[model samples]
Target: MARAGGKWRNAWRKSQKSNLKLRHTQFDAALHNWLLVEDRKQQRRQKYRSLPHSIIHSFSAISPRDVIVFCARKKHDDVAAMLFLQHGEVATYHVGWSSAHGRQTNAHYALLKHAADHFVRCGVTRLDLGTVDTENAPGLARFKIGSGARVRPLGGTWLRIPGL
Candidate 1:
């Protein structure tokens, strides 16, 4: 029975590995083109809400070296934003969206999928989504979950003793 169980476990592991459908892509020149396209769309929707050009410039500067951009499309329109820590371990610091569109299009989903793939390819075993507010950021939590990330509470900060 133990031998049979071992075989079953091995089979399950192999099946899971085979079923893993993560698409990982490296940052390249094509990303610049994609960003331009996304930026143009944001510009067109300036009447509703306009993201500052500085933000795009900053993203462009950082994305090539220490960040990855994950994007999703809605009706051929892409909407997404993210900045991840590229060294040490994979982690996301600030992630936000325009809220102008792509909410119903699941652009966030595609962004997360790409992020996960990117991290895994970079040999990162974990991707920290940072802290959650629970109330104000429920959608953020849901998006992380849909990306197949396990939610775990972060450890509280340490307090240093006065003369220790």
Candidate 2:
């Protein structure tokens, strides 16, 4: 029920001053070396892939900071949520993970927002947010749509392995 409205904006402002800190890093960077490293490590991950990493790497030299991590610090920096994407002409959402505490604190929301802003600054004009299957994952569907993303049909070519 956390729509990107006035209430959410207020919470975002409050969270900035709160214990949670938003970070942007490269895809290859370590998750531990944040503000402070936390002990109790736990998370739930989700992955989506249209092409292999090798394919993406072929286009550009893989560098650091293509990732966004939302860290919540108490005694140490705890990774509340993290998101990774593949970039070309369009930046594609590759994968993401979030902890139970992250869900409670809406870490993914902040993470995605930060990432979108980062991508735009990097000259990326398009960001494909991957699939939104409401029949299976309704919450995820709503989340993506609620972020001002409209549904677009994906166009692609299917080919059989030549030898097969």
Candidate 3:
């Protein structure tokens, strides 16, 4: 956190001011909450494209011991954000989502920082932050880079047929 720049520092401060709290929760509950919020927004004439139910079910079928889920909440216990990470020697961020109010308060920043801290404490050497496609998501790419992660490109893909 000390290495974070002014923007991230300000975001942390903003999250603090909002009285945001992070807690380890069941994945199903967090997903359910996000879906409910999306439903509410759609009813209010706001459009949202949600992930398919099958995806949620597939994720749920994974063993609980293999994944870690955290949910953020404000002072009034309103859901702020949720993060899902797969753990091993190197933890990998699987999914993350934040509410509208969360975006206003930079809840994602706080949640990510917290995740990093937690992984370090658990002796994880590295974290795979997924992709950073600057062309399509410059803001998201910048966010990942700002979090002190370096870009490591993958090598060329290889294909093999059973009987060539």
Candidate 4:
């Protein structure tokens, strides 16, 4: 029954994983942790610091009551964060960034685990994990897949300017 045993082990492992989605201890802490991760990894740091960060300001603005911030901490220091936004039946996997230390600690796995745990309870029937660059971001693509996220080309993103 090696096959059966393997299946059982997998199930057990899945159950042991922590769901960090919307698992923020405090709004401020979550935001702080997010900034730390982004800063350490240079993940969209400039873009965030300028426009999005200014408009969003606080985590409350983006998540309100429907958002979950999952963070991984070490030695009382924030290392990584995964922010999610829920809309109706869809849970959009927003931005996730991690520090160098966080990566060594496999913080993203924890973040993804947490997201899967609480999505259904939050009225999120489907999870939209956004998109990844297969060529430039192969590791990220694999990470998503490893966490049970299937890839599907939802569509392309477009922007328009009112004044041309």
TM-score of each: 0.51, 0.64, 0.72, 0.66
Higher-scoring candidate on TM-score, 1 or 2 = 2
Model 3: per-residue Cα lDDT at residue 125: 83
Screening candidate 3 with a backbone cut-off below 3 angstroms (N, C-alpha, C), the clashing residue pairs are none
Q: lDDT by residue for model 4 over 88-142, one digit each (tens)?
A: 8987777677777666656666666567667766667788877766776777676
After superposing all C-alphas onto the true structure, candidate 2 shows an RMSD in angstroms of 5.7
List, residue by residue over 30-83, the lDDT tens digit for candidate 2.
433332122112111233233443432333344434443434433354546444
Q: How far is candidate 4 from the true structure (C-alpha RMSD, Å)?
A: 6.0
Q: What residue runs in model 1 are displaced by over 4 Å at the alpha carbon?
A: 1-64, 73-78, 156-164
Model 4 score (lDDT): 0.59
By lDDT: ranked, best first: 3, 4, 2, 1
* Alpha carbon deviation, residue 10, candidate 2 (Å): 6.9
Q: Ten-residue segment with the worst summed lDDT in candidate 2?
A: 35-44
lDDT of 1 at 46: 44
Tens-digit lDDT track of model 1 for 31-141: 545554555575566432334545545654666455555544443444545545465666554434534554534444445556766777778776787765567557656
Model 2 misplacement above 4 A? 1-18, 29-75, 160-164
- Per-residue lDDT for 1-164 in model 3, tens only? 66666776777778778778886654664555564454456444534343444554465577554456666777675455444545566777655666678788788787887777777887888888878878866876877877778789977678998898
Best by TM-score: 3
Query: lDDT per model, in order?
Result: 0.51, 0.56, 0.66, 0.59
